[model samples]
Target: MNLSLDYAIEMDQKDPLKSYRDLFHIPKDKFGNDLIYFCGNSLGLQPKTTKSYIEQELKDWAELGVEGHIEAKNPWLPYHEFLTESMAKVVGAKPIEVVTMNTLTANLHFMMVSFYQPNKKRYKIVIESDAFPSDKYAVESQLRHHGYDDKEGLILWKPRKGEELLRYEDLEQIMQDQGNEIALIMIGGVNYYTGQYFDLKRITELGHKHGCKVGFDCAHGGGNVPLNLHNSGADFAIWCSYKYLNSGPGSLSGCFVHERYAYDKNLNRFTGWWSHNKETRFNMRHDFDVLPGAEGWQLSNPPILSLAAIRASLDIFNEAGMDALRDKSIKLTGYFEYLMNGLGDDVVRIITPSNPKERGCQLSIQVKNANKELHDKLTDSGVITDWREPDVIRCAPVPLYNTFQDVYLMVERLKGLL
Candidate 1:
């Protein structure tokens, strides 16, 4: 735990997941040196196997043409099915409860359609004040579409004055005061800005107790944290595969609908041929025999190439295991925090929770009087990190591909800049 380069090197040498770094194609500087990548929270580095995964599909298309749907190596006809169990495992859901389709916000809207059933009396929706912009936009749009004033129908679970993290007590108070008027509670499992991971089960229990449906946007939590979606008992959850999941940028997303709603065919949803019973999907004149569970949420066939990349990443996740990844994440992020604290609070202060259980790998650092110039300098110095507006710099040391040394060198470079 000492703040020394030697200590970081020793930790890397002993890291159980160290070999995973080589499995990913880390970006390089102009000199071809590996750039210290800490932006995995925004976009994950590509897996080495992703090339072959896509290549296999390309080859199949070249040989089989239109017949690739049935003749492809992965069989494009049911390509999304191939990723079911693995994707389900990644989010800790049953296969029947999970599916990979559409993009993140799109899937969020779909889930809202089914879960955010609001009446005039209970029409407001609850979200964290710092919810991701896309989620905010989607929820606002949903409120408007439902003939409710967005400003009036949207309830914000805000942090106390000058606080960076949201408190459960505040949420409990919100439920106590206005739970009757709240129809849905959609929270980000891991807040994108502050790197705070909320308790899904607790939130779900609280919402259900208030006679409101609950869901989560797990974009930041999905692969980075141990999200037991099934056990969390949330009505639904959605996540993109691009970040900690290590799929390509803007790749497909995964959806989780709790088992309780699996057989509820009467639940209103937007559907297409893909949601029909697979056996009867080709029957041109058949009635809509909706497929059971999460598959029923599908509106169209998935893009196989994207799913190929997802499959490659999920294969690695399955091999490394979430439990092992989470263990390394705690140690790795703890070390990052240790180094940041060693840098002295005069220069930089981490806004993320001190407790490892309350956050993921990302540490949002509030650099005193720092601006975009500092971030640009870090980039030019061969460190890749992301900058939020005002004063915060977000750095994520991904457990699958990042190392303790990466964290150390990054901090060292940051200290030098200071």
Candidate 2:
């Protein structure tokens, strides 16, 4: 496979999904050549069609003002409805169970209000040891707010000694040990830093067996991996649209409450005006009747411009189909792994799991004898990858826009720098 650029060129020529690269506007350096973008985990390259979607919403707002709520071709009152069907297919959820609403952290808080019930006896929350900071904070704060001590209420399911990736057995042990005290098991569906995809179904089953509520933070896994949330039996899940979903920064995020709770009025949620029943919403009566399905979780009218960007991205996903997208992703990322592994262990060690099923598009490489200096050098060379402090460098080969040539170019550049 070290057969030079011809191998990469040949792969690109044979890539059936090569046409998708044209759908996104790849970033360029000052010299006017395309920059090798491998940071899709941070932010996805913009879809070329995004402007048109935004323009439609802009025109409606300019012409109709408040009347646009009901006058626009796709009325603002029902704007979010346009997304449900497509979003459901992407995440393997029923339409009634999914809703695109607030930002990721906010949605996490809201989901916790409803699901993370901590009583006097069983009040612990279980999460991965190296969870995203925002997730850690959210769960910790939730614990404190309920008058529970964070140190005691939070149970971390950590990796084995000297191991980077967490195993399902470790989580099972934590649940078995703290089953009576644990109220919830909130995990990152695919670990952000390690790119380790946990077995969702297995975790959910174990949590349920212990009578603990289970949920997933799918921010990294959302569009990058197949999340059969419904079949996985997770009580809830949340994800941001800006990464693999390709929406703009701080775009609207998605929430999935299992169909079992879609109409369960007993589920205690923090409600607002938008959650009120539509028929009585305009009536503004004293009675607070809630809407059926996931729409009930929505607390306010969403920013249509942001949702417009998401719609544009989802259109691309719908055309490509997630299964087809995953197929391309596996091959493209596999090529990246093969090339990186060929670089030898003296300089590089892959922290992400070796099994394709255990990861999405990213590979976290631990650079030996390298600090931020090596990371800085890679950035200076125009290879756009992210660095998490201490040791690892993350590179994500997004199948939608990245080409095989980009991956080859990156490996070649890294080799030269070393």
Candidate 3:
């Protein structure tokens, strides 16, 4: 809880994941000093190794041309495959259950194509009141596409009037009240605005009990926490690599379809050449043999350059290990919480949960009588943080790169701004 610079540096010095901070190219001010970056919840800093990983692909494409599909160091035809194992490992799912394909929203719609099978009797979809806007839009469109009134078909699981965090009991009550009518439950694994990490297994089991299929968008949770998606029993899930996964901006996304659905070819999905069986994918004469598992949802071959970037970042995750990273994250974010609380409730209030287990590295700070102008000031003062609507400032002290000293310095600047 000490706010002294020495205490923060001491904690950073003791951090097992400390060296990871050096792997990223921290943004710098004009004086060449690194900006205290707390924006990983939106976009992760680039890994130093990303350029080389991409260059290798460029080299192969240049030297081998069309032949690079089979002759290159990492073949383009199966470049996406190289990322499967590590990406699955990061999200805690089996290799068979995961695939790196389309971007986040696209993959979400593809998953809904199969999972959001709504009928007249059971057509309602459940989501958090403040689920990421894209998810809300996607589900609403799915409802309308299925010939249901979007507002009538949508059920929002909301927090109490005076609260920001959602309670499992409230969700359970929703299931109880609308269980039979609800066909699907889609939620953000970690709420973007609040940084609340809902218990995925609890939600999935509740949905299953109520005869509803469950899915999650783990864009904020993917590398920030151990999702254990397999154990969660969610029918499907999707996450982007640009944020906590550090794959670069607008990078490809990862999708997870539970093993039970792997061979269920009867499950309807959109298909393209890439989703055809690998053995006959290039045959061009064979019928559209939709591949099993999450791969079946893909519509095209992925951009190799994007996959290359993902491979570069996944390589780092493989080395650091998710468990160890999460371990540091808990401690790191705890330190952040402690320091922010030290800022005094009169000046700042944290909308994100105080319980470490309920959130990731991000803390949504609500400043009393302040606005986005405060965020701009922080940015001008050489600290990078995200400003949400109303009065919240989102700052994520990502464990893989952010340090204790960075947290201390950022908060010290915020105190001055206030």
Candidate 4:
């Protein structure tokens, strides 16, 4: 709760994960000083190891040609598998339930193909009113593809009048009223705008109680929050690596399918040679033998370069461990909140939840009468933040790289502008 610069420096000196900041290549300003990066919720800072990781793949390609598929230091044939266990540990799922493959939206569509089995009476999908634009569009396209009118088939779980956060009670009422008509519940694990982390287990149980399949878009929650996807009992989940996972921009995404579906070969899914059994995959004349579990959802062989970058980042996550990162994240974000609150509510309002368990590292701050110009000022002051439409400026003090000093300095700059 202390606002002094000495307090911030002391916290940084004592932080167990403080050394992690050195592992990333922090972006620099025009004068060559490191910028205060608080945009991890949009795109994470690249790890220093990412360059060498990609270079190794380039070396293999140059030296071995096609033989690199099986001859490289890390074989390209099973490259995605190298990421499974580490990714599962990050999201609190089993190895069989997780796979790294296509981009986030693509994986979401593929998941919907199998899980969104709409019948005559139950043919609707429920989503948050303020979901990320891509998620809303994907669900709408799914409804259209299934021969339903998008407007009629889409149900929005909206916050009450003038409210910024969603209420579980409102969701329960929606289920009580229209659950039977709802075929699936697809929600953001952590809301992008509000930064409200939903109760995954509670949502899954409620959806199940009403005979609906539940899934989550974990783009904002993946590495930033401890999802525990398996125990939540959600049928499926998808997330991008470019955000909190810290892979390069537009890198591969992670997908999760519950273990209960591991052996369900009968489930309908779009597949390709990559999803076939490895033994018979090269036997081009054989019938398709779909691999079990999340791997079965793969549509093609992944780009090895992207996998290499993901592996590099996952190695760091494996070393630091999500539990320790979460502990630091709670303290760091709490410090940021404490400092922001001292700025007075007249000038700033935080839309994100106050409870540490109900949000990740990101805090969505709405500045009174502010516009894009305010965001530009912060950027000029060497603070990298994201500005949403209207008035919110989102800042994430990532535990992997951001420090208490970074948080303290950001507030100081904001006060100057105000």
Candidate 5:
């Protein structure tokens, strides 16, 4: 079957979500044409409105000084609060259960410190074999910090032999074998390399049934997928806003502590002044009064500029609800797969889950006989995609801004490269 590039472009022209493509500042090549940007899974293209939101914060900082905390157009003291309701809506979480806080890894450690209560009997943590590097490092460091050998405390739930994806049954089998000795199950909500979105509700239920705490490193899942973290009953979760959230590089990340854990004072946590009771915080009392919800996890004042970028992004998210965004995402990414598969297995293979419900926006393609050279060729040809080590290129067509034509054009470039 001939893959007609013009047909894909025509599909883009008729796409209902096509107008969103203009919302982002798509990158230009040396020739100044918009490059095919399929790297939203890495760093999303910045929103065109980001400048104005940042400008507002910068102007307020210039004019108000410390007074900006109280008197600025958007008061810095409660700026994060402004984001709560909308961000909660985007992630299928309750407002009190979520907070925009520290970086992803930092928040992961903080949450683990509170949730991963490894005792003498149950001192193990189970994680996916292909978990992100930072998450593995954080979990390993936590084990060492608690005086447990990583080999003893860390249990990896791996894929089957000669397989690229992990099955839920594999996780169930591990739980049956070691659940009695496991204290926590920390898995990436979406596998970073394979783009597999786990069945969070099922995983959470399995973990709880086995008397284990469940948490998620949602860096790849957060905005890219509709994660009902609250309803899924995940004890805790962390996600960065820079990727699908489109909040700029190194932007503030988010943390979620289920509403069930909100007022559980018996629950352990590493607290700070920001987590102190806001009502009497200004009074400067000696009592370690903690906030009622996830805000109780805050350690320091968040950078307003970073939060400003988040606000800009969340505003866009609020306008384009997660359900609508996800609907578009399935169709767009399916188109990407359809186009890539058209090239046939002799050239490329998609490792990401075939079922759209089982994955998000990313399609991890393993180019046969292709090293970094083929990836570089695609980059040089103006198709921007990410190469994960060994041999996989990840391309995410974000529903918020990526059009069907972007996916179509990207495949055409790869066909040319081959």
Candidate 6:
């Protein structure tokens, strides 16, 4: 790949997805120049239509009051259903297997309540050693809740010495040794720090071979890659909408329960009013006739404004399609990786997988002889990327709105910083 600015501009000119960049509001510097944004892994840029999406709901609420539940355009009662089909498409699942609901950690706990059934003979849980702190905390609490010692009951799958990415063989060895004693296997679909995308189907099959339930926290994988959750055959999975989904901060999370459990009335779960049957939902006090599939996990009615923001973003995804997005992302990040390689192995080291299939659009860069001040300087220079703990700069070039020129400029800025 050419490192010249003209080459980058030429690549952008010939791009099929160049028009998508104008769909979002890109941030600008004090001088009014657009900033090279690389932090979509932390929080995605707002889509141009998000404002109108929320304003429509506000307009309906102001004019129709309680009548907005039924009379308003898009109707508030089944607002989440509006997002189901598109969201399912992003994560590669059937509509009946997916639903938009609570926050990431909350949904993780709710899923554990149903899937983490432990017994004296098999009561341990396995997760990556470097999982997001919230997932670690949630699993620890689940262990204690079931009267097991947190540290004793929780098993970690660690990388070998001098390695950053996890090997599938190491995990297989863990299952080989402790499969009979483990009741659950929960893993991050993508490692947030290293941008390593795990093989969900392989992990699920290995867990199932040992009679263990499997699940994934797809907070980093959602919209960033083709998860194919249904094909993975995981018992359940959850992901947030704020990051790659670009649904605004703290938007509702998506939950996926495999079709095999869709109509399992005997399954143990924590249910609420929102999970009841739509036919008898407003008929006052009655027995809880739970809705089928992932909808049966909802605890309360959702906030429509957030759902509106999600709907706006998902509409864009529906138009662009995940297959198209994945194709562009492979090229975008491949270019980023190529440029970073030109910086010399001594100057900066890339920890993310070189194999495009093993990662998404993110590349975790580690600069030699650098500290947090270096990152601050990059921000001052109008480039935005995040610094993870220990040593690594996490930058995701989102395919939906990011361009070839943006990736080129970001690398040029990093070269200057070095």
Better of 2 and 4 by TM-score: 4
lDDT of 6 by residue, 95-194 (tens): 9999999899999999999999999999999999999999999999999999999999999999999999999999999999999999999999999989
Q: Which residue pairs overlap in candidate 5's backbone? A: none
lDDT of each: 0.95, 0.91, 0.92, 0.96, 0.90, 0.94
Which portions of model 4 miss their true places by more than 4 Å?
A: none
- Candidate 5 TM-score versus the reference: 0.98
Comparing 3 and 4 on lDDT, the stronger one: 4
Report the CA-based lDDT of candidate 4 relative to the real structure: 0.96
Q: All predictions: root-mean-square deviation over Cα? A: 0.7, 1.0, 0.9, 0.6, 1.2, 0.7
lDDT of 1 by residue, 1-418 (tens): 7998999999999999999999999899888999999999999999999999999999999999989999787799899989999888888999999999999999999999999888989999999998999999999999999999999999999999989999999999999999999999999999999999999999999999999999999999989998899999999999999999989999999999999988999999999999999998988799998999999999998998999999999999999999999999999999999989998888889999999999999999999987999999999999999999888999999999999999999999988998
Cα lDDT of model 2 by residue, 203-307, tens digit: 999989999999999999989999999999999999999999999899999999998887788889989888888877988765888788888898998999999
Q: Write the per-residue lDDT of candidate 5 for residues 262-299, one digit (tens) a residue.
A: 89877789988889888887887668888988999998
TM-score of each: 0.99, 0.98, 0.99, 0.99, 0.98, 0.99
For residues 197-219, write the lDDT of model 4, one tens digit per residue.
99999999999999999999999
**CA shift of 246, model 6, Å:** 0.5
Tell me the spans in candidate 1 whose CA falls farther than 4 Å from its real position: none
Mark the regions of model 2 whose C-alpha exceeds 4 Å error after superposition: 1-3
TM-score of 6: 0.99
Candidate 6 or 5, higher TM-score: 6
